[model samples]
Target: MTDQSKHEVQFFTLHGKRRAYVKAGEGPVLLLLHGLACDHRTWLPVIDELAKKYTVIAPDLLGHGVSDKPRADYTLGGYANGMRDLLTVLGIDKVTVVGHSFGGGVAMQFAYQFPERTQRMMLVATGGLGPEVTPLIKFIQAPGWFPAMGVLTLPGIRHVETLALRSAAAYGGGPLRKYTRDLAEVADILESWKDRRTRFAIRHLVRAVIDWRGQIVTMSDRAYLTEAIPMAVVWGREDQVIPVRHASNAAALAPELRVEVMADSGHFPHKDHPEQFARILDDFIVTTEPATYNRARFRRMLRSGMARADTTLASVDTALTTA
Candidate 1:
């Protein structure tokens, strides 16, 4: 275990509300984004390693941790905008954004919207590129489940904490013993879920998923293919949630992108294979240059407008074909 004393956990205001985050080490800025239901603590192990060479900023996305969760639509774009605002407040002009699972979607959106502010990007077990969602996730998305799931708010129930932690481990195929070992932390996360702010965030996220179900298919057809961004993708071959197939599909869509597969790991490859993940990230950062905006590509995208139109038409074709 790394020395906890070496790192500091703090909070800052973004958009007028306080957001909690952990900052460690010193060097080039690296932003770490966690997936659904996970807080900044999920990246603790990796942060311990990366902090040695980089200034790591890991924030609890609104409503998931010690952050302020306001009731609003939690779209990928919304999260990206929040990150942009946070970076602006911190005066971080450029960042190597690392996103996992849902965070990957946020990272991609951020890079697309603010290319000038992003140095590079790394996505792991990300969404927004694939149509394959796991059975468990589908179950979560099932109608009428939201209201009952909201029952997680019943106060003073110690068992709810255990249940939440167990659910997280089971869903991602992580080591159960590690989660169970930290009873206090688990309790904190579960208790946070009961908070009104957190509950609002949860409801917003549920709606966001439903509303953006086909977003990736929609975005892929766009001319963003000229994304000259120095990007890399890492995924566990055994990823059950997003599946490994999407990794190939995403790489196919962006041929210039770099991808690495981690065998025998699950959704959280960074957690399951920290050393290898770190090595791949280190090599990419060392060798890759900052992405330069291509004016011609952007202009073509605007002139054709065919990308967006094609994406919409393709989606219609797919729906009819499937139907």
Candidate 2:
């Protein structure tokens, strides 16, 4: 049986709605957060492999997978708090949080909100780091596009999509070929629009972070607060959904961010190189010391020249460690 099949999804009720997730293995806790229009299933490629050494918990955020589609809070902070509640129920406090694309934003929020519980962070082609994003995403979250999406997501549209691609390939020139190829990248995303719940979720949830003009809620300024956490960033060089340059931009903002670029992959590097992704994540977790966040010290850093850390890493006490 495949790793995907081996793990059975368990359900956890939050706010009177069920959130489906897969919980497996034993050891240090590791939470895998999926990107937009995705569920915990996205982690199946690396789940069992990484579960060998760590307790891996991958959840279907409030609206994505088998989880209930309630018109609830789907913002990063909301997602982060939901994760904390899940961890609390399982009696797992500190964890290494790994997020991909949209999940990356949630991971950062998780670290910021509950620093003491965040052991480390790993972002894979994370979103909400910059203003640059796919025109498709920008348009999907646009104001006037909501009503159009209703018609666009009609079940028959998928058949139309296939026919259009075939026609483009058959009769069209270089320009149409390029358009079709680009459309192919997001074809699955488009297919997902057929689901009314998914469409609603994507429309509402994405708008919370993104606007018609790329991403609106950027976390660049908050990078300084992560000085104490060991972080890694993995980006696909060919990521068209979110540019690879955002990885460099994030590295510039965050201190000691270990950025790894997957040359051959596109938007989903973890799926492209699951074994390597798992290896990179395992190495980081095993080698680095987990960070602890003290609320008082966290506040102090904001006040004490955040521009330059005249202060060292802060622990439970006010004492500073010059790491």
Candidate 3:
């Protein structure tokens, strides 16, 4: 409702299942992915700016927003596959992927599994690469937590959802006062929250996280950095959730990777600094070579490098123990 003239909400089916997405602008394709407990609306601020120069495709990942939520396994691989199907349905052979938080992990999987199909990737406050997850996230991801949160259905669920959204505004590293006053926005968020499937999908994500530990998937940082795909990483300097240390490791993984640290921002840099985020992405797209982005070779090199790095780290640990 914030003058969304540039965006048109649309829906399409990937493999006979319906999914909803917001399309805006008319230049090159740029797919936007949101984090957990969020839908396409999370990118509203950033999309407003990005639509000016790029054809932005912000989708409600299968179970998130207006999309069909099947009671099936919602692994990270499943999310990546769903994206691949969505792109194929939309006739998008190649695209620039911009992902935030959990979406960042999915974007990495997409690039790793289908590297040639990705033009470039920008990760913002991404997961998977970092070892430090916040205590709040750990609490939410704890087993059997969904049933506890289900108390929202008792009454005044809208009010409860509004409080949750407002609380999340703090996670954005911005003041929560202004966002809480928007009653209509809070109402929409509550409506989305009413979905039972969303809770199930979140639980599935928890299991996936446990499974992903010390395991290589399509979205690992090693894959993103070593892959021939041009990549950049943006982090909120004040990020309490993922922390800036992860950004440092990401840079080490890919020395050539462009890294930007946004001041006074939190996990959601796009929302906190839309103009700056857009400018960084636009510059990367313009300066990077599209043809050199190869998928298979990148995976091979990344895997080899990861093995070597692991051995080196192990040796360092042994030396410290002996000392």
lDDT of each: 0.71, 0.79, 0.70
Q: How accurate is candidate 2 locally (lDDT)?
A: 0.79
Ranking by lDDT: 2, 1, 3
In terms of lDDT, which candidate is strongest?
2
Error of 2 at 142 (Å): 2.1
Q: After superposing candidate 1 on the true structure, give the runs of residues whose Cα lies further than 4 Å from its correct spot.
A: 1-6, 139-143, 150-192, 211-218, 294-297, 300-323
Question: In candidate 2, where is summed lDDT lowest over 10 consecutive residues?
Answer: 314-323
Candidate number that wins on lDDT, 1 or 2: 2
- C-alpha TM-scores of all predictions: 0.80, 0.85, 0.81
1-323: candidate 2 lDDT, tens digit per residue? 11245689899786798888899898999999988887787788899898898999999888787788878888888999999999998889799999999999999999988898998999999985677788877776777776787787677877688557556534655534433433433555666666788778888888899876667776655677778799999988878788888877777667587999987667778877899999999999888999988778888867764545443323201211110
Q: When superposed on Cα atoms, how far off is each prediction in RMSD?
A: 4.9, 6.7, 5.0
List residue ranges in candidate 2 displaced over 4 A.
1-4, 160-185, 305-323
Give the per-residue Cα lDDT of candidate 2 at 188. 52
Cα displacement (angstroms), candidate 3, residue 96, comes to 1.2
- Compose the digit string of candidate 3's lDDT tens values, residues 219-284: 332443544778889988877666666776666556778899998676777777888888888899
Q: Which ten residues in a row have the lowest lDDT in candidate 1?
A: 210-219
